[model samples]
Target: MAEALREQQLCLSRFIRDPHSNPAPPGIEARRLAVYRQLFLGNMQSLLAGSFPVLSATLAQTQWQSLTTEFYACHRCKTPLFTEVAGEWVSYLETRSDLPGWVAELAHYEWIETVLLLSDNADPAHDPEGDLLDGVPLLSSLAMPLAYAWPVSHIGPDQLPLEAPVEPTLLLARRGADQKIHFARLAPLAHALLVSLQQQLLTGREHLDALAQRAGVERGALERQGIALLHGLKAQGVVLGTVRG
Candidate 1:
């Protein structure tokens, strides 16, 4: 009896997930199945649209519907939470070949805002008044440095590029004290600097010294400019502050 009930449930789920290909379970009315399919698909679309507003707006009406429908029918979402549906869709898009190559990157770019806003990571113990150059600076747990092949920030209905730029688009996404997510483009050097800071527990001067060696510039020259840049990032809440120790 349990096996039969489980099979029935699977059949119903398959039909709801892909009604076009999977027939309804035996004895279920077509009207009732239609309602179930509509409700499930509608909720999925709404959640995706809310999370990836730019991606939805970039695709045409039929294109958007087809994209959402295919994702709904084919992708087996690993997460049970509705909030994570966008991330699952982004992962799904990465595997798809029919869509534009940039689609996944753009979806990820859009979805990052949702990730930052919903992040539960708390600020680490640090001194907001500590010296940035002398003390090891701490990057906010919520700050992320993203690099993509396509210029995701510029892709929209009116500005889709057929070819990727020679240089990758580098972006820093961070949540401010006001609990709002902010995004900014980063120069290659700046991007490298932020990534180094995030990955290592190093003092600001040490980070800049390494950057200078790699960049083949005089340590004094880079240190002067890098110190100011770090301070600016601190003002923006990207640099949480120096470590307490």
Candidate 2:
């Protein structure tokens, strides 16, 4: 009895996740079940794909179907509620080895925007708190900084090319101080710097020095450049808050 119940649960969830699958069995009449199953899958797919249009575009119909199938199968999403599905879809891609690395990053890049826009975090607006010279911190309230070895930002089916550009670009995606989500192009030096900050590697002069050593650039040069980049981040609303005095 328990096993039958489990099967029913799996079948129902599958039907909900993607209605375009194998037909329902003996007792579940195809007529009414078909309406619900197809409707459920269509809506779920549309919601998730809309959020990650580029990823959706890059994948073939089969690939997208398979990817989402795997997502529903392996990932135990706490919420059976449909809204949480997209977030879990992105999470599964991140942890799954079969997913293309670039695809994973692209999925995440897409997911973060929706997640942030819908977030309830009460991180009130505050002026970026320090002098650029003090090696102050910079970040956006809705702007969660991400660093990727794969150039996921500039990726599309063919248009926004994904090959890691020889020159790395820092990506700052944020719901603006004006309540708009904005995307910024970042320079390599600046990308590296923000990455450092995101990873807790650089913040003050010490953070700058560490990155400078990695790049083999003069310490003084990076310090000057760091401050300049700091100013630029604030201008773009990338500066979220100070690292704390």
TM-score for each of the candidates: 0.92, 0.75
- Residue pairs clashing in model 2 are 138-239, 138-240, 139-238, 139-239, 139-240, 202-207
Q: Tens-digit lDDT track for model 2 on 181-218?
A: 77676667777777666666245677788888998989
> Given candidate 2, what's the lDDT at residue 165?
61
The residue-level lDDT of candidate 1 at 98 comes to 79
Backbone N/Cα/C clashes per model: 0, 6
Write candidate 1's Cα lDDT for 1-245 as tens digits: 99999999999999999988987899989999999999999999998888888889998989999989999999988999988888899999999887888899999999999899999987879999999999999998999999999999999989988999899999999887788888899988779899999899999999999999999999999999899899998998889889998
Whole-model Cα lDDT of every candidate shown, in order = 0.92, 0.70
The alpha-carbon deviation from the true structure for residue 165 of candidate 2, after best TM-score superposition, in angstroms, is 5.2
